[model samples]
Target: MANPMKIRAAVKDGVTEVKVLMSHEMETGQRKDSSGNLVPAHFITELTVVWNGKTVLDAQFGPAVSKNPYLAFKFKGGAKGDKVVVTWKDNKGDSRTDEAAIA
Candidate 1:
């Protein structure tokens, strides 16, 4: 299992801002390892963010993304105490889901 994601959500002036820090190796197959062998590509392929059961952000990531990615986004119509959920699926079939309440 991977490390738990760090999520922070806050609402201000009817806009909710969410920040997330995802933990992943994000290895690209083109890279060479210590043994001079090509490393298998492993990176988050899809990501989604939902607030109050409504989709707020849906994105796709590729090998170009850096390891331990950090994302920040804003959406309208979220209130305090509402839930913000984030989910990501990697190319290797591994996935992670986490949530936070709006402050």
Candidate 2:
């Protein structure tokens, strides 16, 4: 599992726009290290966003995603003071969950 992550989110109107910067070393198997050996691919595979316990979005990722991925999206039906939760899981079983108060 990943160390505790930091989440930043906000709400505008009836929408919640969230941006998450997860700390990770998303290693792609196609990359080579200083020793010229192929590094095993280890990247986030799943991501989901929820508002007030209702799922708003879900996605699956691959090695192509950038390191320490930053995701931004908007969800409808969000209200002020609602709780927005973001969670992710990596291929190595590392996971994280974070929440921020809307508005």
Candidate 3:
């Protein structure tokens, strides 16, 4: 079963710090299920964080990352009411996008 993800962020002093928690099984394809079936590998492929319409932090990940992956990073040039967006996609092409406004 896949878990639900949570995202957190804070903007202060013109800097925005963001955290993302993505819920996934992250099967490595080498694993076997209780029924002895091979679990196909499925993991995060790319992740990006955008601040005020600009890409601030970008990353690539693989199956080794871990289940319920956690990502944290910092960005610059922001203030109250600014928008910060984070998007991530899995190897299977599944994706999710979320945003937070500077407070």
Best by TM-score: 1
RMSD of each: 0.6, 1.5, 2.2
For candidate 3, which ten residues in a row score worst on lDDT? Answer: 1-10
lDDT of 3 by residue, 13-100 (tens): 8777878888877777888889999889998889888886789988998878888888888777778777778788888988888777
In Å, residue 49's CA in model 1 sits off its true spot by 0.5
* Higher-scoring candidate on lDDT, 1 or 3: 1
Given candidate 3, what's the lDDT at residue 7?
Answer: 70
The lDDT per prediction is: 0.94, 0.82, 0.80
Q: Which residue pairs overlap in candidate 1's backbone?
A: none
Q: Pick the candidate with the highest lDDT.
A: 1
Writing each residue's lDDT as its tens digit, candidate 2 over 39-99 gives 9989999999888778998999998888888888887777777788888888888788888
Q: Which scores better on TM-score, 1 or 3?
A: 1
Pick out the ten consecutive residues of candidate 2 with the lowest summed lDDT: 1-10
Clashing pairs in 2: none
> Candidate 3: misplaced stretches above 4 Å?
1-4
For model 3, what is the error of residue 9's alpha carbon versus the real structure, in angstroms, after optimal superposition?
1.6
Q: For model 1, what is the error of residue 6's alpha carbon versus the real structure, in angstroms, after optimal superposition?
A: 0.4
